[model samples]
Target: MVSRILNATVIGIISGIVLGAVLKVIEEQTTKKVYTLLLNIDFIPILNSIQFGEMGEFLFHLLFSIILSFIYMSWTEKSSPNSALAYFVKASIVTFPTILLYFPLSFLALKEVPAINDIQSIMFWTFGHFMYVIALSVLVYLQQKKPRS
Candidate 1:
């Protein structure tokens, strides 16, 4: 049990790092082009700000990923037929309320001061959350699928 938990934690951290890197690359490339196209603007300043201050984001996601992995493992342990698909469905259900709640709260708490009016920004932010959930779910599925030795 201890070993399984430890393995799950390690897998979660690795999954988090991979997901974060992929997101960062996608954001850099896509945001750069999108911003440039929309406003004839460069994303250097935004990227610089993030570079200086992204540790909290990374830690938060890492911890959340670890928790999600544990939850999925627990669910799988219940062992119904089609457990993998059930886990995926359960994950999606769990993610829905988070998606619904976080975006408005994030906008209100963080972006309200600037009064962000860009629909694209809103969409991108929500899309990031969706991708995070998907990544975590995939990690959980992969961990659950590993053969016991």
Candidate 2:
């Protein structure tokens, strides 16, 4: 059990790093800035303007990705190896709330309206988060398909 959890955590961290990279790529490719989630880090006293106001954001995204991935991966292990379509449906339903989670966190941190500032911004958030979930599903599915060591 401990080993499984450790493996899941490592995979979850990988997923989080991948998610962060994907978002960064999207930000670079798009004209609009879509990763303003870090702007709300003022809520954390110790992280105030961490690493000259950059590392905090990266840490936040990475940490959140790890957390979400850990939960999903652990849960996936318990579930039967269902069809790909069913897995996707389950993932989408589960990960569709990236915005919902972000909004409140940002609001509490910034004391102002957060998330969905515009359609473009919201789309970016959705795209990044859903993509993360899809990636998790793919990894888990691949693992399930592999022969046990």
User: What TM-score does candidate 2 get on C-alpha atoms?
Assistant: 0.76
lDDT of 1 at 1: 92
lDDT of 2 by residue, 1-149 (tens): 77666766666667666666666676678744545552356677876655545565666766766677667766677787578776676667667777566555555655333344556756776777777777777776776667888
Show the lowest summed lDDT stretch of 10 residues, model 2.
Answer: 109-118
What is the Å distance of residue 133 in model 1 from its true position?
Answer: 4.0
User: Would you list the C-alpha lDDT of every candidate in the order shown?
Assistant: 0.55, 0.64
List model 1 lDDT by residue over 72-144, tens digit each: 5666567532555566677666556644643344344422221245555555545655665666566667766
- Models 1 onward score TM values of 0.60, 0.76
lDDT of 2 at 126: 71
| Clashes per candidate, residues 3 or more apart or on different chains | 0, 0
Top candidate by TM-score: 2
List residue ranges in candidate 2 displaced over 4 A: 38-40, 49-53, 105-115
